[model samples]
Target chain A: MTTYNLALIGFGGVNRALAELIRDEPQRFSSLGFELRVVAITDLAFGSLVQGDGIDLAAVLAMPRGSSFDGLPGGSSDPRNEEVIKNSPADIVVEATFTSPVDGEPAVSHVRWAIESGKHVVTTNKGPVALQGTSLSKLAAGNGVRFEYEGAVMSGTPVIRLAHKMLGGLELNAVQGILNGTSNYVLGRMEAGLRLDEAIAEAQNLGYAEADPTADIGGSDVRLKVAILANELLGATIHPSDVHTTGIQDITSDDVAQALANGLRWKLIGEARRESDGRIVASVQPIALEADHPLAGISGATNAVSFTTDLLGAVTVSGPGAGRVETAYALISDIIAVDDFVKGAVRA
Target chain B: MTTYNLALIGFGGVNRALAELIRDEPQRFSSLGFELRVVAITDLAFGSLVQGDGIDLAAVLAMPRGSSFDGLPGGSSDPRNEEVIKNSPADIVVEATFTSPVDGEPAVSHVRWAIESGKHVVTTNKGPVALQGTSLSKLAAGNGVRFEYEGAVMSGTPVIRLAHKMLGGLELNAVQGILNGTSNYVLGRMEAGLRLDEAIAEAQNLGYAEADPTADIGGSDVRLKVAILANELLGATIHPSDVHTTGIQDITSDDVAQALANGLRWKLIGEARRESDGRIVASVQPIALEADHPLAGISGATNAVSFTTDLLGAVTVSGPGAGRVETAYALISDIIAVDDFVKGAVRA
Candidate 1:
């Protein structure tokens, strides 16, 4: 049995949920033909801890909210993310930091450090993937490591990996998706006679929206996801700024009602297509789709991506766009990818 | 470069379309890091032809419908399917024969012969996969080969493989799909104010339904697919007769109008779910789905499968259920599976 040692970069919700799964479910990993052991952990609030063999996950998870890892072996009050990442005896680094949309800081550097140190990376952050995906991917490949971020685009819905692995050999002309769950849920509530502000409040109360809801509602978050999908899947060299973005802020309750009266649904759609002139155009905007449209039925906090291929026509996949455990599954998927690559490389 | 020699059984629409792709597109194969060569072809109408150096697909594809392979070198008037499948210098057998609803005859035999000969098999026929999948898979595994049937459920839509490869590690509880496109098309037409017969005629006119159309409209087609999906994905040892089957024939135009008025759509749904006591329940019925259901938005000839999982929620995938080029692409996908298996096994 192949056991992989992991360095968890952030003690956030996503990583915590993953640790819980690893501790609770041994059969899941055994079924996938591998075992996972957390060797190092770094956090902004909880501080840092490193155990070369394996860390006691239950103890760490049971710690109080404001407590630090000061009494633990090899523990420090400071995160020391870079030092822990570069020198940890871990085959893979699990990065689940905050998305710095501007420059994709910290997370990108964390990914780079792990890659440069020849450790594979699995991240749930959109920042590093959307902004620095190409160079980071090249760097990892050049170093015989894998840089995987399946959670960036649709948060464990398998959008990026689906296009990369499942839908191979087909000419994928375009990809359009309902990428954001907050906006989608808000739109659904708007159709049910709620105003934008009311819907947003409901979303926040339901834990779908963050305290700073500007990114989710303003389309910038989707912009980063679109940039990642375009660059990684469509072979386009694009930054987040390149996507022309507009959110559902303008689609009012009256607009939603009118569209519903006319058998249309308002949705925030992020799209990227290869044009005839050999340019890949990426955008995020609100569109009124008919009842039969692939993305129209995606209500509530569900997300979907419809790939327009030359052969398969419009193939769509819809699932949860956000959740701690759901997003954590993306990391598990990425680790599976890492395991496959390493096993294949052993023969190579 | 890896070149896989193929024996195409039943050079019908699907195999011919695959031949056309191999003839027209070289870049597609080059991109996948492999080359495909058809070394043997057997058709009930055109007889059998085997050339160890690879046959001219263009000439064979261009041949008239009534023509036999008699005039060509290494050709016979009789199909000689067993001999061609066994004796040909082919690494994989591509089976695209007519599906047998009752016994899964000739196609099952073809798959068996190919597997017993220590050759990988990729088939688009539902008969073999639905009826004899477990035994054939065991035989192939014991013989150090593979038996893949991605096209059997939903032609070229990637349903089986998507669940097999992409959704690994998740606990899949149930799988439900709009497996039969003809029934779906007919129901959609009925929703547009057409009678069942009229809607079926429209489907036939659009080439979505066959002349008989009994298997499609009577829910037998969905039963086989459900059996295959239940047996394959959910790890159930069940036959096609186990499914409680119903069709869209009883759904009248009035029913369609009533459902539409109430914000629902009639769909022929095939489902297999693991019950609490560990028994698998499979059914095919005309379900009046709310607009937000995962399989509701699938229109016309498009097919979809919604997998209920522990982590990802209801992950749904939709695409074209049937087409010449599309079903042919399923063969390509299965061949890729074969390639991956062979490469992996070499190291094992």
Candidate 2:
């Protein structure tokens, strides 16, 4: 059987969920004529693990926190993540580290190293992609590898893939979407007469928002998503900071009521459009959309993107934007796509 | 430049639109590392034209309706379609033949011949795929070729491709959608206080419904679509006639009003759900969807499909279900997909 070795650079909720899915679907990988083996894993908080062959996913899952790999040989409680990447026998690098859109640090360097070293890269880190997609894409292409980040924008919704593969031939003009789920959930609750702070609390209690949900609520997450879309769909080299952004913090019940009065719904939408002069303009703000507009109907924690193109008019794809299983599935899907690409290349 | 020869089986509105798209976008095809050359075209009404090198697309577009291929070398006004399929030096058989779901004849035979003759097939004909997709798929596989019908179910909306390629790994349990634009437009107008007859007439006036709209209004179109989805998604070998179909012709304005009064919208929904015993139960009927349902927001000629999967929850893709450019774009996309597959095989 064909085999692919993986180096997971983060062991957070999303990565752990991916391990669970892999364990549960043995037949799936085998039927696809391959087996996925995680040869190394690295996380800042939980330390690192490495094995030349493959790690026992079940053993790691059963271990106590902080000491999961203490007894295992070649495992360290604090190891440089780059060490795992530089020496691991892996064909794909699965990056799920914390994002820093300010400079796209750590993840950006990791992706460059992976691609330069002849490994395909799949990431959920939005910062690195939004900030460095153009450079990263060029790097990957030069090295004859793939740098896919489908989970970076809309979790597992296939937004970027649809734009690049399915609608690749069309000249896409604009993209409007609800990219941040926490903000949408809060706004949806606010529409039901809840105060913004109360809505935020409810969302936090429901695990839809983090304790410090600044990136999601302050519009930075949507900004990054819009930037990613601009770069991926419009072929624009835009950083997250390049987008003019507005948060949903000022959206009160009065605003929701007024929008409803005008037969509209308030949504935190991320928009990117190609200007007539071949420039991409991107922004993130709350817009009062008519009830019939595609994005207006998207409700709590659901992400949807509508692509306006010359040949196909408007095509929309919607699904869960972010969840453990959802994000993991995106990584899995990317791996599969990379596998197909590599197999095709080898055939050629 | 790499060149791919094409044989058009029907010169209908959709095929003409596809030709126009290919003609209009010279840079698109050239940049993709391939040039498409139409080697032959066969139409029941307008006759046939065959040239191993390339048929003159511009001349055919400028000619009179019935005499499009007249005065051309090796052109016949009453040529058999099979003759072109058998004799043409084509890499792809672009089939837009008239669909006969009763047995998926003619189109089924055409596809079988194309595959057996070692040529790829990209079809917009729904009959063959819905009635005999399993056997046709097997035949194509046996011949080491592709039999793609991305435009069959929802014009060029990427329904089948999304289900098969993008979401292939998920264990999808159910699929529900508004598959027919004619029926949906009529029901949408009926909900706005128009009589059923008036709605149908308005749709006809708008060119959204055929004069003899039996296939669309009678739920047969959606039946075929659901059967195709069942086969493609759930691996259920089912025929359109096996579905319990119900037409929107019987739904009066009063029924729509009642549904609206109950805070629901009337929709001609095609649903397919996999049973516990691995049986797929599919049907096409009018259902009143709750206001917040994913498919509830689709309006006018827009079509939407919601797939329920074990890993990703519900993923929905919606767009123009049937339009000249829309459907034509689907065929082009399928051609591109086939090209990628073929190139990969050559690499192997």
lDDT of 2 by residue, B3-54 (tens): 8899998888888988886677878887766789999898887788999988
lDDT digits (tens) for residues A1-348 of candidate 1:
999999999998999999999999989998988999999999999889999889999999999889998888989989999999999899999999999999999999999999999999999999998889999999998998999999998888898888877787999988999999999999999988999999999999999999878888999989998998788778999999999999888878999999998989999999999999989999999999987788888888889999999888888999999999999999998998888787782212
CAPRI tier of model 2: medium
Full-model lDDT for every candidate: 0.91, 0.87
B233-256: candidate 1 lDDT, tens digit per residue = 999999999999988778789999
* DockQ-based CAPRI category assigned to the predicted complex of candidate 1: medium
Clashing residue pairs found in predicted model 1: none
Query: Candidate 2 lDDT, tens digit per residue, A1-348?
Result: 778999899888899988887777878777666788889888886678889789889988777666655457768887567878877888999999989978888999999889988999999889789888889989999999999899998998888887777786787899999999999999988888899999999999999999998888899889989999988888788778889999998888999988887879999999999888988899999999987787887888999999998887888999999998899989988887788777774223
Error of 1 at A35 (Å): 1.5
